[model samples]
Structure formats: C-alpha cells, structure tokens
Target chain A: MDLKTLTIVVVVASFILYIAIAIWAKARSTGDFYVAGKGVHPIANGMATAADWMSAASFISLAGIISFAGYDSSVYLMGWTGGYVLLALLLAPYLRKFGKFTVPEFIGDRYYSKTAKVVAVICLIIISFTYVAGQMRGVGIVFSRFLEVEILTGLIIGMGIVFFYAVLGGMKGITYTQVAQYCVLIFAYMVPAIFISVQITGNPIPQLAFGSNLAGQDISLLAKLDEIVTMLGFNAFTAGSKSTTDLLFITAALMVGTAGLPHVIVRFFTVPKVSDARKSAGWALLFIAILYTTAPAVGSLARLNLINTIQPGEVGAVDGNLKYSDKPSWFATWEKTGLLTFDDKNGDGRIQYYNDKNESFKAKADSYGWKGNELKVDRDIMVLANPEIAQLPNWVIALIAAGGIAAALSTAAGLLLVISSSISHDLVKGIIAPEISEKKELFIGRVSAAVAILIAGYLGANPPGFVAQVVALAFGLAASSLFPAILLGIFNKRVNKTGAVAGMIVGIVFTLSYIIYFKFMHLELNNADNWWFGISPEGIGSLGMIFNFVVALVVSKVTEEPPQEIQDLVESIRIPKEV
Target chain B: MSSKENREAYWKANLKLMGLLLSIWFIVSYVLGIVLVDQLNTIQFGGFKLGFWIAQQGSMYVYLILIFVYAKKMNTLDKKYGVED
Candidate 1:
C-alpha cells in the first residue's frame, strides 16, 4: 500500500525465508554444520560466496563512495574483484584438497606446529571481529532508517536473526540463507539503478547508461558529470586524486586481504571437489561482477542527479540554487539522521555543496553572497538516498532498506560461523579437548556463535562506533598477517613453523603500529605528509606483508628447516590429485 | 618421464600458467590503472577514459576471465597428468 508497509512486507518476507531455510537445512553433524556436508554444488556455493563477500560495504556503501568521491573510489571495485583470481587459482583448490574445516587447521598442520594453529586462530578472531563490527553498523543504518526504529533496536533485531540461523545451522544454514540474500540484495540494488539510469539517460542498463549521452543532451554522462563537478571545484568525476604510490599499495593490500579473509576462503571448502572449488570461484566472481560493474553507474548517475537537484541551473549564478524551503522531502528525511546537514551560513536559505576548500572557489563564493558551503552530505547516504533523488517509487526505497539489511546480516552470519568454528573446532576440540564427541563439538559451536553475536552487536551499537573506514583495518590485518602466512605455507614448502610464526607476528605488529600511529596516536599525521613514502595506513599492509616475507625467509634460513614430513605435506597440498 | 616426473612437469606447467596470469592481472589493474593512469588517460574508448575504465570496470572483467581460463587450462593439465580430481 505505502512505502512503510511495502518495506515491512519485503523485509519480513526475506527474514522469514532465511529463518525457514535455516530451520530446514539445520546441521545435524559437525560436517553438516561446518561445511554443508561438503556437498554444495559449485554454482550454489558460488552464489553463497557472492552473498558472503558482498557485505554492507559492497551492497550499500560502495556506490555512495563512488558517487561522491568519483574516480578515487575505483580502488574498491578493482581491488576487491581482482582478489578472486588469486583465491580461485592459488588457494581454494589446494585448501579443499587439504580437506580442512578451518583456515587455522590448514595453517597448523601445514606448519606442523600447534603454536602455528594457535597464532592463526588469534588472527582469525581479531580480523573477523573487526569485520563483523562493520556488518553490525550496516544493519543499524538500514534499520534506523527503513523501519524507522532506533539503531539499537535494529541492531538487536539483526543480532537475533543472525543468532537463530548461525547458531542453529552453522555454515550449512548460513549458505542457503546467503543464496536467498544474494538474490534479494542484487535485485534490490539493480532495479532502482535501472530505473534511475533510464530516467536520466533513457537506457535500461545502468552500465550502458553510464557511457551513453544524457536523455536530452549530446555529451556523455561521465563527461557531463566531470564537467559539472569540476565547475563546482571538486575533482573531475572521471579523474582521481590518489597518488600513484598510495594507489599501488592500497590496491595490492585490498587484493591480498580479500584472498586471505577467512569467511570467503572457507566458502571454497563447502564445494565437493578440487575442480569444483576452482569452478566455484569463477561462478562467485561472475555473480559479484554483476553488482560491481553496476555500482559505478549508480554512483556517477546519482552524483549527477544530486548535483542537478541542489544546483538546478548555472553553477555560479545565485538564483540557480534551490530554495532551502523548496528542497525535496528526502533531504529532510536524511537530515533527520544528521547525515545531511544544511547550515545556510550566509542565511540565504539556499544549499551549496561545492568544494569550499578550493582556493579559487573562495573568490566566487564571496561574490555570490555565500558565506561558505552550507550543506554537508555524508558519503554513506548516497545509495540509500538514490531512489528518493531519482523520484522512484516508495517500494524501491523500502527494498534498499531490506537489501542493506540482507547484505549486512548475511556477511555477519558468515563471519560469526568462522569465529565459532575456529573456537569450537580449532581451539577446544583440536587442542583443549581432543576426546570431545561430535555432538558436544556441535553444541559448543552453536554456543560460540551466539556469544560472538552478542559481542559483535554490542561493539557495533556502542559509542566510538566502528566507522566504515575500519573495514580497511580489517583488510590490512588480513593482508599483513594471514595472507602471507597462508600463501607461503601453500606455495613455499621451506617455510617452517619458526619462520611462518615469526612472519605473522612481525607482519601484524608492523602493520598495526603503522596504522595506529597514523590513525589514532597521531591523528594529525593521517595524511600523505606523515605517511611512509606517502603510503596510507590502508596500504601499509602491503609493506607489512613484505616485512613478513623477508623476516620469514631470513628466520627460516637461520633456523632448522621444515621436517621432511612437513615438506611432503606442502607437496601434497600443491598437487590437485591423490598420489 | 617417470610418473613422478610427469607430475612434476604438470605442477611446473601449472605454476608457469599461474605466473603468466597473475602478471597480466598485476599489469592491468596496477600498472595500467595506477602507475600509467596519466599516460593512458590520453587515450579514450568511446565514453570511457582508458585508465579509469580499466581501474573500475575493465580489470574486473579480466579477473573473471583469468579465473575461468586458469580453471579450464588446469583441468586439461590435471587430466593429462592423470590427476583430474
């Protein structure tokens, strides 16, 4: 009937569907719970992987960043998508052949040391916790807006949903629920994008519309966008500002981290065969690419629409700006979240969203009776605000809410499973209680999942909230610690326990110190001037990974090499077939 | 070659293919998109800028291709070495 009603129906329907799948496919054994009995189809596993991989960041925040930051945001699209190549070819098949349940198990056995296993579990916990916090934040944002509930209320509901499925079904239930999530999120994302594209460029395909001319204009959409943004003192929409050094390192870090993430790599273990693992990666990216390609379109088109809406005519003309009183209802809706604010500094009752920091634009602003830029737009609001900006149906707005929630919940459930399994399977069963029964192990896994949800939810809702940028920290941690260790363990047999363990420790310490130094300890130094060789904290992980490689190599040479059996273990994982 | 020799050869070939694929992957996203973005920006492909397009959309498409291509070629390598699984 109305926007709120449709939103409830869609969101409720999806939640019921996910809970039903969780109940129907609830795990009966540890194998069933952890790896879906290792019987998932390559394609189904691929879809599930897509859902798990596309977190709130991918489904919701990415387009918003791309829309506002323009070409600077391409790092996310290319860096994340390209990592699957490494995973499918370098890691997935071998890990599947190794036949392990958890990433740390592979690390422990491959390194032939219990200490290695313990180290990996620690890293897994930290990385997964950092990641799950972002997911919780995503859930909070979606709930606070779409359902018109407090963020805490939304987070509690989200935690409850995840607890039911993740604690009950483990990876098995999470997988099926994720498949449904992918369908809902992808549909919700694309339908509005297609509508907006057509409204602006008369092209049904957003990707095609991105390249096509505007509906009544001869200039291409991107070119027009470039012209408009630069006129307002922002960087050209098609050109980017990240330094070559920073871009190189950031992209490298993100790619390695994506491959190293435990939640994603674990998905490969669900498929049946080594070949299927390989195929599954291909399928996962194919589905992921659909969203990745469309994001840039939604971003740029939405940016153009927002700019035009705010500055309706000539850029510099005072009369061109929309009267603050005449602004659209969505502006007010988002303003209530405190994400979009208007100061009307000159008290002219008009909004100006130009780059006030530009030196040259200061002269123009003074002449135009503008005290300063009067509007503050949060980068996180673009995707959620797109439907309203495009004047799309209210149902589309509701779907975006559901889509954001679905993305966050699926990713949270997946990460919770990783954390739980690492605790129950690796820590408790592998070390503390080797004689525990399967039934007991399964129960422990469920309890661990529930507990993790509570902790993650609390962290997500509390003050000093983990912003979206901390996701980069999670990636950095994974890149610096797990990726180098895992890749070296598989690709280089000479890496002994001493070396692998030393490398990970060194990597984590170095990366975290650099990140913390710039990010927190010296917040004023969080810029290119203070960065080592102009490498941002996000990109420092690549340097940390190099430290790991070098340290491991040096340590291994000075210490006793891996045992003959460990060498053979490496050789086994390297090969795809049985001896 | 002996059976062990054949397996070694298969593994070598796999490594070599992987090296080639990964290098291309590196060149496309890193070199073209970041290192040589300015030079490539001089060139245009219809409505898309060459470097920006490669960075955002093009590299992703190639990444998809690279994985599938590696899988197909590896399957043949596996079968030839009698290690299809």
Candidate 2:
C-alpha cells in the first residue's frame, strides 16, 4: 500500500484500540469516573501520567523550538522534567494520603472553607481550559498535515474521539487509553530518532550521538553545529543567548507550574496507596525522561541536516545555495502545507536560508548579491517533517502522524476530565447542591465532559494566540495560584482559610494583570527592557509564587491560628499510615 | 516513647532528610546548571560543554535518582516509626 493508505490504517487501528479500551473499562460509578476507583496500579498509573503529561507541545513543537533556539531552549528541557522531582518529593505522597478525589477537595477541607474550594475550582477551570486549547491545536496540525483535512474538520474528528471516551470512561477509560497512547507515542518518537542517529552519527542511541562525532568525521556534532550556525549569523548551537536570570526564573516557573497543574496532581489520586504515589512519580519521570533526553539530540541533528541540505557548499558562495528546481521532495511536500515557503528576493532562483536580520551579516550578504533570507520555515514543522527530511521510510512518517495525534488527544482528554469534574463535583455537588445523589452527579460529570469537549474543539479551531505562549500563560497561572495554596495547605498548618484565600486571590490577580498589560494590552512594549526586573511574562510566575508565600505568611500571622482539627488534619497527611 | 513522641521524631527525621536531598536538587539543576554555567562551560566533557550537559542531561538523571532515593529512605523511615501501611 502507499504512504497515505498506510498512514490511515495505522491511525485508524490506534483509534479503534482506544475506543475498545474505553468500552471495556467504562466507568461504573463516580468513584471510577473521577479517580479510577483509587485502584490503579503504580506502574500503569505512571505510564498514563507520562502520556497525559507529554502533550502536543512535547511531541510536536518542542524539538522544533529547541532546534531553532539552540542552547537557550534548555529552559524547557530541564524545566519540564525537573518539576516531577518537586511533585515526587514535596506533594504527591501527602496528597494521596489525604485520599481526595480532586485537588480542590483537599484545599477546601484543609482550609476549612467553602470559599477556598470555589476559588480553587475557578483556577483549575482557567488553567485546564488554557491548556486544553493547545492540545486541540496540536490535533488540528497533525490532521491537516498528514490526513489532508481542513483544520476544523480535524478538530471535529478529534473532539468526537475525546468525547466518546472522556464522557463514558471518565478517568478510568482515559487512564487505560493513555497507557496505550504512551506506548504508541514513545515508539513513534524513538524509531525516527534512532534511524536519524544512525544516519548521522553511526550511533544507535540519540543521546550518545548528541555528544559524539559525526559518522566518519573527526569533529563532534555540537562543535560542527556551532560552526555552521555561527557562520550563518545565528547563535552557536551549544551556547545560550538568553540572560542567565531570565533562564533561572523561566525554569523555576515551569517547574513549579508543572507540579501545580491540576491534571498532573490528580493522577496521583488514582494510585492505591501513599507509597505508590511516590513510586509512580518516579516511574513517570523515568518514562518522560526517555523522550526528554532524546529531544535535544533530535533537535541539533535536525538543525544540522536542514542547514546542510539548504547550503550544500560555502555559506557566502553564490553557487552554494540549492537551486529552486533542485530542491528536495520533502521541501516541496512541506511547502504545499503552507508551513514552509520560499521567496526569491534577488530573483536568484536559489534558496538563501540565513539570519538576514543580523545587522553585522547584512554587509556581507550585500557583497554576495543576496537580497535577503529567501526561506521561511515554521518551527512547528521540524519534528513532523524530520523523517521526510532524513529520507526515512514511509512507515516511519505514518507512525509520527499517529504519535502526534495520540500525544495531543491524551492530554486533551485529561484536561477535559479535570474541567468537567471541577464543574460537576466541586461546583454543583460541593457547593451548589450538596444533597445531590451519586447517580445524578455521575450524569452531570458525563454531560459536563461532553460540553467541555465541544468548547475545547471550538477553541482549537480558532486558537487564541501562539500555542506555546498561551501554554506558558497557563503554567504561570497554575504556578501563581494553585501551587502556593495547595503547598501551604499541606505544609503549613498555621495558614487559616482567610490567609489562603487572600494569597490565591493576590497571586493570580497580580500575575494575570501583569501578563495582560505586557502581552495583550501593550504588545509593542513586551520586551525585556519594559519587563519588571528583566523578567519576561513567561517567567513572572516565579515572582508571583514568592508573593503568594509572603502574603500567606504575613496574613496568617496577623490573624487567628487555624483550628486544632485543621492542624491534626495536616499532621495526618504528613504520615503514610492511616490512623 | 509515647505514640505522640514517636510521631514528632519521625517528622523531624523526615524534615532532615528532605533538607539534605533538596539541597542536592537545588545545587545540581540551579547551581551547576544555571548559576555557574558560564564558568563550568570552560570545562569540556567528551562531546559536551560541562554546563550544557548538566543542564540538559545530568540534572535530569540526578532528579530521577533524588526521587527514588527519597522514596526508599522514606519507606525505611515509615517502617522504623511503625507507620508502614
């Protein structure tokens, strides 16, 4: 069969498998629907969390972002995976010992206030919605590129799949399906990486190849990449251009936010015991690290391959650039998707791919008769186009398409579950109608899930802004608001309901206004110079988290202490054994 | 010791363990990976600059180890305190 036919078969097979699992493990009660009956084995929960955590951002855009930004993107590499350490050490076991169905439940009970639960529910809703939007966009990208469908059509199809499982199986169904997705995505990611590693560095392991010499060449890969990119006026591949302070703050914000995310924290609730929670976090990070470690290698290798393909000879030489007619089949293929475009600025009928915006490079470019950079490549296309660029087999290309969809759908389903549970369990049942029956609550959960999918699908069709930037905002919100409240609730017994509530309000409000004023209201002034303390909007959450810590401490000191029962509750969660 | 005294001692030990482990965690990723990156980059490690390798690869490995070690140590502490489930 041809590539298109084969891609359809693989993608369809995966979908059918997921639907079957959803049916077989369909939720029977609110217990199963919300927390998988709290019976998930540690290892299974770990695999599911890995799939739920590595969204379209990690599978599709991350390598591309790393490739273009070079060493400056280490913030993502370390920031994302390092958060698991915080989750494992600081949060997971205690939350599991609390044995709650949702993150907001713990906050409400610990703070002894209905208002605190409501505040947490709102934060969860905002963070999950912002996050789910990015996943929908990922689904659209995969569908449009591989399945040759319109973005809206792709999103509708994605919504249909998520609605069926998420509405029916709830957390139980999502968990099993996610386990399958983790297998599919990791296989799809590694196969191409291994092939490319062998092709470029004669090494089977991409991580080893990252630092090793190119095949039959004496110079190491990073050194060669640095040489080529610098010659083209781009920053060195192994050196960072971002200030150290910005990197520090950005990395910390991402770490804290990852730990604070409701979707991630809820996964720990599915485990059977407190010890299992810590063990599963370890397993989840190990599985996630498999992909995280390989990403930088894939990024650098892809960058090196792209530059060699574009400029086959000396950088400044007139005959060096590839002729338009001689461009590779992959170039033509990606160009049709409107993601990769070429412009003959000098009408030279050849490609010039360089940093033309570099002031120092402009004089040399003029001397070479090059009008400007003639190629524009979107960063999101790097991983999706990698197999084609490397001339890998057609099957590998098909696998990547399925893998991208799986990553996006898995995370989207997880977020939708969180959003739905927040509305049905936290809002309607916890506050609005405390006397509701379990059966009625389960029905509400399913309906809300379906509605959330529809809303998420609509947003996917009409994305609010750049997917990465929106995702950063989601993390910042989670870090500033939920993380501090949840951390204080468990770690500090002195923080009263009023203190916790005030801290969350101050943290989220301050962070949101700062982001809006800089990012949306004053777009033209959203640079490093205009930022407070040289911190970008992306890194502002770290400072907000600090503010939350300070406000909670001071406010609690000035007010009455938390009741004795609340202190007992805090002491109870700190231990592994149930009293 | 009374049950309350046992609980307090276990909590104190847990705090001590966390402080030590968290210190290592901070030093690996934040100190070596970011703060001292420029100075460490002068030292090469096979195919990588020492700092870049630590940031992208070494810190992650250390993070994995830190979690497992904490878990193992906590398990022992729980058993010793007669709190194992």
Candidate 3:
C-alpha cells in the first residue's frame, strides 16, 4: 500500500484501540479519574510512563537535535535519562506515600495552605499546556506529511482522539492506552533504526552499530563520519562546537527540569505502593533507554549517510558530488515536503551539501568548482527521513509515521488530563465547591479536557519554536518552580506556607522572564552580549531553582514552622506502610 | 513497639542506602562523564573512549541498576523495620 493509505489505516486502528481502552477503563469515581484507581502493575505503569515521558520531543526531535548538534548533544541523552534517577531516588516514592490525587493536592495539604495549592495549580497548567502544544504540533506535522491532510485538520483529528479517551478514561484509560502506544512507538522507532544499522554496519543493535567499523572501511562508523563531514567543511561527528561550561549547564538544567515536570511526576502517584513508584521509575528508564541508547547511533549513522549520498565516491572533489538527477528516492520524497531543498544558485548540475556560509569553506568550494550549497536540510526531518534514507521497506516507513503520531497523541492526552484535572478537580471542586458529587466532577472534567484540547491545538498550529525547544522551556519552568515547591513541601517540613508560595513565585518569575527576554526581546543583542554570567536563558533556569531552594530555606527559618497537624501529615507521608 | 523507634530505624536505613546509591550516581555521571573524562579518554572500549561511553551509555545503565538495587535494599529494610506493605 501507499504511504497515505497505510497512515490512514494505522491512525484509524490506533483511534479505535484508544476508544476501546477508554470505554473499558471508564473511570467510575474521582479516585479512578485521578490515580487510575491506584492499582496499576509496576511494569504496566512503566510502559505508560515511558510513553508519557518520551513525548513528541523524544520520539520526533531528539534524534534530529543530535544529528546536527554532534557530540555536544550527548547532553540530551544524559540529562533526560539522569533526571529519571533523581525522580526515582528523591521524589517518586514519597509522593506515592503521600497518597494524593494531584500534585497541587500534595502541596496544599503538606504546606497547610490553600494558597500553595493554587500556585502549584497555576504552574502545572502552564507547564502542561506548554508541553501539550508541542505534542499537538507534532501530530499535525505527521498528519500533514503522511495522511495528506492540512496541518490544522490533522491537529483537530488528533485533538478529537485525545479528547475522546482522555475525557472518558482519565488516568486509567490513559495508562492502558499508553501501554499500547509504547509498544507501537517503540517498535516503530526501532525497526527503522535496526534496518539502517544492519544496512550500514551489518549489526542489528544501533548502539553497537554506531561504534562498529563501516562496511569496507578501516575506521569505525563515527570516525568515518567525522572524516567525511570535516572534509565537507562540517564539524566532526564525535566532537562538539559548544563550550564545555555551556554544555554542562545545559545538561544540568535539562536533568533538573525532567525530574521537575508535573506530568512525569504525577505518573508515580498511579502506583499502589511507594516501593512500586520506585520500581516503576526504574522500569520507565529501562524502557526509555531502549530508544535513548539507539538514538545517537541513528543520528550519527543518518548524518554519515546524508554526507555520503551528497558526496559519493571521493573526498572533497567535484567528481565526488552527487548529481541532481542522481538524487535518491528518499531525497526526492523529503524534498516534496520542503524539508530537504536544493538550489543550484550557480546553475551547476551537481548538489553541494556543504556549509557554504562558512567563509573558508566557500573559498574551498569555489576552488573545487562547486556551486552554492544545494542541500538545505531541515534538522526536524532527520528521524522521519532516516528509514527512507536507508531504503528500508515501506512498512517501516509507515510504522515511523504511526509511531510519531502515537508519541505525540499519547503525550497530548496525558498533558490534557493534567490541565483538565487541575481546572475541574483542583480549582472547581477542591476550592470552588468541595461538596460536588463525583458524577458532576466527571462531567466538568470531560468538558474541561475538550476545551483544553481545542486551545492546545490552536497554539500548536503556530508553534513559536521547534518542538524540542518549546519542550525545554516547559521543562525549565517546571524545574525552577513546581518541582522545587513540591520537593520542599514533602522533604522540608519547616517550609511554611509563606516560604513555599514565595519560592514558587520567585522561581517561576525568574525563569519565565529570562526566557522571554532572551528568546523574544533580545533580537538586537548578540547572544554573547545579552546573557548574564555566560548563562544562556536555557541554562539560567538552574540558577532559578537554586534561588528557590535558598529563598525557601531562609524564609522558612524566619517564619514559623507549619502547624502541628501539618507536621503529622509530613511524618505520615514519609512512612512506607501508612497510606 | 513504639512508632517513634520504628520510624527512626526505617528512615535511618533508608537514608543510609540513599547516601550510598547517590554517591555511586555522582561518581558515574559527574566523575566519569565529565570530571575524569579527559583522563580516561586514553582508555578505550570497543571503539569508544571509556569516559565517552560512561557519559553516553554506562551512567544510564548504572542509573537503571541503581533504582532496582535501591528498591530491593529498601524493601528488605522496610521488612526489617516492620513497615513492608
């Protein structure tokens, strides 16, 4: 079957599967809606968490980032996975024992202040909304490409599917559906990767294939890639152009941010026991690692393949250049999407995929009788275009399309769930009308989810930046604000209401302002001229988190400790068997 | 048994294990991946520098193992303190 037909079939099948799970797992009570009835098996929860955690950023853009960013990009791999360790060790188990339905619920009770709960609700909404918008955009892109639909139309359909299941099943439906999604997405991701790995290195495991010697080469795959790229005036595949300090701060920020994300942290609350939360985190990481470990390999191999295709046969010479007519089927396919474009500005028949903008490289290309740069490859196309580059079977390509959609939709549903619950349960019921019946609350939750989906879909239609960049912003906000507040509330019993509230406000304000100033307001200033203390807006959020920690400590010391009843609540949450 | 003594023992053992695991975590990620990476680059594994391997793959594998090990150890501790679920 053709790509369009296959994509439609896969999407329809997934929709039906999601609806089936939602109906089967329809939440009966507030408890079922919030925590999946707190009976999810550890491994099952792990799979769901993996699906939830991977997001559109992981499935679609991580490889793309690594593909271009080269060795410095290892920070993403380390930072993302390492954060799970912090989550598992520092936060997950205790939150599980806290036995709360929502993150705000935990904060409000622990801090003995409704104001703290409200602040957390605001932060959760902001973080989850920022994240969900990216997922919706991801779905739209996949739909536009594979299903031959307008981007907005694709987003609406994705929104509808997310709405149906998420509204009906809540966390219960989302959990089970995420299990199915994890299976589809992981299989979709790895099949193309494995095929490419075997084709390039005669190895099935991408992680090993990355390091193995290329067929008919003396050097390893990375060394070969490095040689070709540098020959073409690109950076080496295994070395980075970013400063070590910048890399360290960026990686640290991402790690802290991952541990702080509300959607990911809330997954721990679904498990039955504190120990299960701990175990579930491990299982989740193992599942994530399956893709994370393979991704760099995929990125490196794709970079090599791209360079080799554009410059076939020889190194840095006119005779080695790939003729426009000789471009592969994959090149033509991506070119149609405008993600891969070529313009022979000098009217040469050959395609020059080099950094012609580099003054030194331009001089060399001129001397070599090369035209202007021919290939304008969009980094976003790397993973989606990989299977085609390797000339893999049509089914693998179809699976990739399906997998990308699944990854996006699964995360969209999870984030939408959080947004809806915060509005319906936390704001409306918990604060507005605590006496509302379960049925009424469920009705409100469904409506809120549908509305949230519509708003998210609209924002996604006109994304401000790349999906991963937007996700990073969301993570930074969460790390600096919500994560710190939640952690302090549980672990530091002396953090009174005033302290928690002050800390969250300060952290969120600092991080958000830094991002807005750098990303939106500082266009006139060179990057080197703007950022304070060499901390780019991306990494400055870590400083915000530190500020939060200090302010909370100092404020709590000056203020009275939480009341006796709140102290008992803290002690109870720390104990394993009590809840 | 007094709840105070039981809670103290449970938390003490848990904190002790956390300290040990956290130290390993720091060593693998910061020590191997960053601080000592240059020194360890001379040591090779397959085709990768040893420090690079730790930065990319080894630390993640260790983190996964750490969680399971911590869980198992904590479970045993929970039982010892009569706090097992």
Candidate 4:
C-alpha cells in the first residue's frame, strides 16, 4: 500500500482505539472528570503521564533541534528530564497526600485564600494555553502531510478526536488513551532510530551506538561528527558553544518548570496513594528516558546522514556537492512541503549546506566560486524526513506520522483537561457556585472542555508567528510562579497567603518582563553581551525562581505565621499515611 | 516520643534523604554537566567526551536511578515510621 493510505489507516485506527477507551472509561462524576477517581495504578499512570509529557515538539522537533544545536541542545534533554526528579522527590507525593482535584485547590486551601486560588487558575490557563496552541499546529501539520488534506480539515479531525475522548471521558478517558498513545509513539520513534543506528554503526541499540565508531570506520561517531561540522565552519558537534552559566540556568528553569506544569502535576493526583505517586513518577521518568536516551543518537545520526546526502564528496572540492538536478527523491519530497529550499548562488547548480554566516569560511567559499550557502532546511523536518532519508519501509514512515499525531493529541488532551477543570472545578464550583451538585459540575466541566477545544483548534489553525517563542515563556512562567509557590506551601508552613501571593506576582512579572524585553520588545539587543549576568532570556527563569524564594522567605518572616489549621494541613501532607 | 514528635522526626528524616539525593542531582546535572564540561571534555570516555556524555546521556540515567532510589528508601522510611499505607 502507499504511504499515505497506510498513514491514514494507522492514524484512524489509533483514533478508533482512543474513542473506544473513552467509551469504556467514561467519567460519571466530578472526581472522575478531574482526577480519574484516584484509582489509576502506578505503572498505568506513569505510562499515561509519559504520553502527556512528551508533546509534539518532543516527538518531532527535539531530535532536529539537538542535531542543529549540537552540545547546546543538552539543555532541553537535561532540563526536561531533570525536572521529573524534582517532581518525584520534592512535589508528587505530598501533592497526592493533599488529595486535591486541581493545583489551585491546594494553593487555595493551603494559603487559606480564595484570591490565591484565582491567581493560580489564571497562571495555569496562561501556561497551558501558550503550550497547547503549538500542539494543535503540530497535529494540523501531521494531518496535512500524511492525509493530503488542508490544514483546516486536518485540525478539525484532530479536534474531533480530542473532543470525543476529552469532553466525554474526561481525565479517566485521557489517562487510558494516553497509555495507548505512549505505546504508539515510543514504538514509532524507536523503529526508525534502531534501523538507522544499525545501518550506520552496525549496532541495534541507538543509545550505545551513539558512542560507537561508524560501521567500517575507525573514528568514533562523535569524533567524526565533530570533525565534519567543524570543517564546515560550525562548532564542534560535541563541544559547548553557549556559556556554562546559560546552560546551567536553562537546564534549571526547564526542570523547575516541568515539576510545576499543572498538566503533569495533576497526573500524580490520579494515583491511588502517596507512595504510588512517587513510584509513578519514577515509572514516568523511566518511560520518558527510553526516548530521551535515543534522541541524541538519532540526532547525531541524522545530522551525519544529512551532510553526506548533501555534500557527497570532499567539503571544498569543485565536484564535491551533489548536483542540484540530481538531488535525491527524499529531498524533492521535503522540498514540496516548502520546508527544504535550494538557491543556486553563483549559479553553481550544486547544493552547499554549510555555515555561510562564518566570516572565515567566506574566503574559502569565494575561492570555491561559491557565493553563499545554497541550501536551507527546516529543523522540524529532520525527524519527519528521517525515515525517508534512511530509505526505511513505507510502514515505518506511516508509523512516524501516526506517532507525531499520537503525541500531539495526547498532550493536547491533557492540557485541555487541566484548562477545563480549572474553569469548571476551581472557578465555577469552588468559587462561583459553591453549592452546585456534582452532576452539574461534571456537566459544566464537559462544556468548558468543549469550549477549550474550540479555542485551541482556532489557535492551532491560525497559529501566531510568535507561538514558538511563547512556549518558552510558558516554562518560564511555570517555573517562576507556580513551582516556588507550591514548594513553599508544602515545605514552609509560615509562608502565608500574602507572602505566597506576593512571591508569585513578583516571579511571574519579573520572568515575563525579562523574556519580553529580550524576545519581543527589544529583539535587537538579545545578544549575550547585553544580557544580565550572561544569562539569556531562556535561562532567566532560574533567577526569577531564586528571587521568589528570597522574597517569600523574607516576607513570611516579617508577617504573622499561617493559622494553626493551615500548619496542621502542611504537617498532614508530609506524612505518607493519614493520622 | 509523643505522636506529634514522631511525625516531626519522620518529616525530618524524609527531608534529610531528599537533601542528600538532591545534592547528587545538583552535582551531576549542573556541576559536572555544565560547570566542569569543558575541562572534562578534554578526557575521553569510550567514544564520547566525558563531559559531553554526562550532559547528554549520563545525567539523565542518573536522574532515573535517583528517583527509584528515593522511592525505595522512602518506602523503608515509611515502614520504619509506621506510616505505610
């Protein structure tokens, strides 16, 4: 069968499976809708959490980003995975013991203020929305590419699948569906990586193969990659280009942000017990590590393959580069998507994929009669086009398409659930209509989920140009605001409503302003030289988090202590078993 | 000890374990992975630079182990404190 047909069949079959699970696990009460009735087994919840955590970007863009950024991209891998440690050790168990339906609920009760809950809800909405818009766009892209449909049609189909499961089955449905999604996505991701690893390094294990020598060559893969990239005027593939301070701060920000994300933290609330929450976090990280370990291997292998395909011979030889007219079929396939482009600078009729921005390389390039770099490839295409570039079977390609969709849909469902629950549970039931029936609250939850889906779909369909940049802001906001607030609420009982609220406001505002000043308002001055303490905007959240910790501590010390019950509440959450 | 004092001791023990484990976490990802990366890159580990491997692969593996270790140790702590659920 053709790749397109195979992709549609696989994707549609997965959707059917999700819808079936939703029907089987349909939520009946507010508890089921918000927290899956708190009966999810640790392993199952871990798998579901893994699916919810690995978004479309993780599936499609991360390997590509790693390939291009080289050592610099370690921030993402370490930052993202390291956060789970924080979650497991510091956050998950206590939050589970708190027995809350939403993050804001804990903040509200712990801080003993309705206003604090409102503040948290607003932060959750902002972070989740900023993150979800990108997922929708990812779903639309996968659909358009594989199903040969317009992006709009693809988005509607994606939205419909999410709506069926999320609105009807709620958290219960999302959990089971996400477990299946984890299976599909991990399998799809690994198959091509295994094949490519075996092909290049004569090894089946991608993680080990990454450090091994090429199949017939004496030099190691990393060594060869370093040599090649440096020869092309790029930084050595295994060397750090960014300042160490920046890497440390960025990694810290991502770790803190991951632990703080409402969608991820809520998954812990679904587990049966406090111990289960800790165990489930471990399981989630293990599952996530399967992909994380393999990603660098895939990245290195893909970069090597890309360079070999483009520049088949010596780097500077006149007859080195592949003739543009003789470019491979995979190149043409990607070019049709407008993600890969070629310009015949100096009318060479050959592709030169190199660092044209390197001033020193300019002299040599001019010597070779090369006016400039003649090829431009989007980073996202690296993962999408890897199977094709490796000449893998049609089924493998089809599986990749399905995997991307599964990733996008699972994460999108998780985010939408959090958004809806914050509205219906926290806003409507907790504050607006405190006396509402459980059935009415469930109905309101469904309605809000449906509305949230529509808004997400619209944003996905007409994604703003800044959607990509805004995602980092989501992590920054979560790290600076929610994480510190939650951590202090649990660990430091003296942090009253005033201190916590002031800390959150200060952290969020500081992080937001710094990111905006560099990323948006003053883009021209975003260089390292002008940055504060050599910390880029991407890494500034760690600073904001520190500021939050300091301000909260000082403010709490100066003010009255929390009420006796609130202190008791803190003491209760710390114990694994109830008194 | 009174029940409240027992709970306080249990919480203190839990915090101590977290402190030790979190210290390792800090050293691996930040200290070795970033602060000492360049110095360690001069040394080779198998086919990878020592620091680069730590940054990209080793630290993540360590994080995986730390979580499981924390879980197991906490299980023991819970049992010792008569707080197992």
Index of the highest-lDDT prediction: 4
User: Could you report the DockQ of all the candidates, in the order they appear?
Assistant: 0.81, 0.77, 0.61, 0.85
TM-score for the first chain in candidate 4 comes to 0.99
Better of 2 and 3 by lDDT: 2
Q: Tell the DockQ for candidate 1.
A: 0.81
Q: Report candidate 2's interface RMSD in Å.
A: 1.2
- Clash pairs for candidate 3: none
CAPRI quality of model 3: medium
- For candidate 1, what is the lDDT? 0.90
Give me the displacement of residue A263 in model 2, in angstroms.
0.3
Error in Å for residue A27 of model 3? 1.2
Instruction: Note the residue pairs that clash in candidate 4.
Output: none
Better of 1 and 3 by DockQ: 1
**Residues A445-466 of candidate 4: C-alpha lDDT, one tens digit per residue:** 9999999999999999898888
Give every candidate's TM-score on chain A. Answer: 0.98, 0.99, 0.97, 0.99
Question: Which residue ranges in model 2 land beyond 4 Å of their true spot?
Answer: A466-468
Model 3, A1-579: lDDT tens digits are 777787678778877887898899988887888789999999999999999989877898888888888777778888899888889888999999988788888888888778999999999988898788888888999999988899999988888888888888989999999999999999999998988899989888988897899977678887677778888788776666665666667777888899988788889999999889999999999999999998888888888888888888785665688889988888888889999999987677888778776777878888877767777988877898888888887778888888998899888888888888888888999899999998899889888988998899888887766555556788788888987887887677788989889999999999888887777677566285567767777777788898888888899999897899988887777778851
Candidate 1 residues A1-579, lDDT tens each? 988889989899999999999999999999988899999999999999999999998987889889877778878888899889989988999999999799999999998889999999999998998889888988987888888999999999999999999988888999999999999999999999999999999999987888889999889998999998888888998888889888889988999899999999999999989999999999999999999999999999888888999999787797789899999999998899898999988877888778889898889877877777888988777798889888898888889988899899999999999999999999999999999999999999999998999999988998354355577898888988999898888888788899999999999999989987888788897989878999999899899999999988889889998999988887777777765
Residue pairs with colliding backbones in model 1 are none
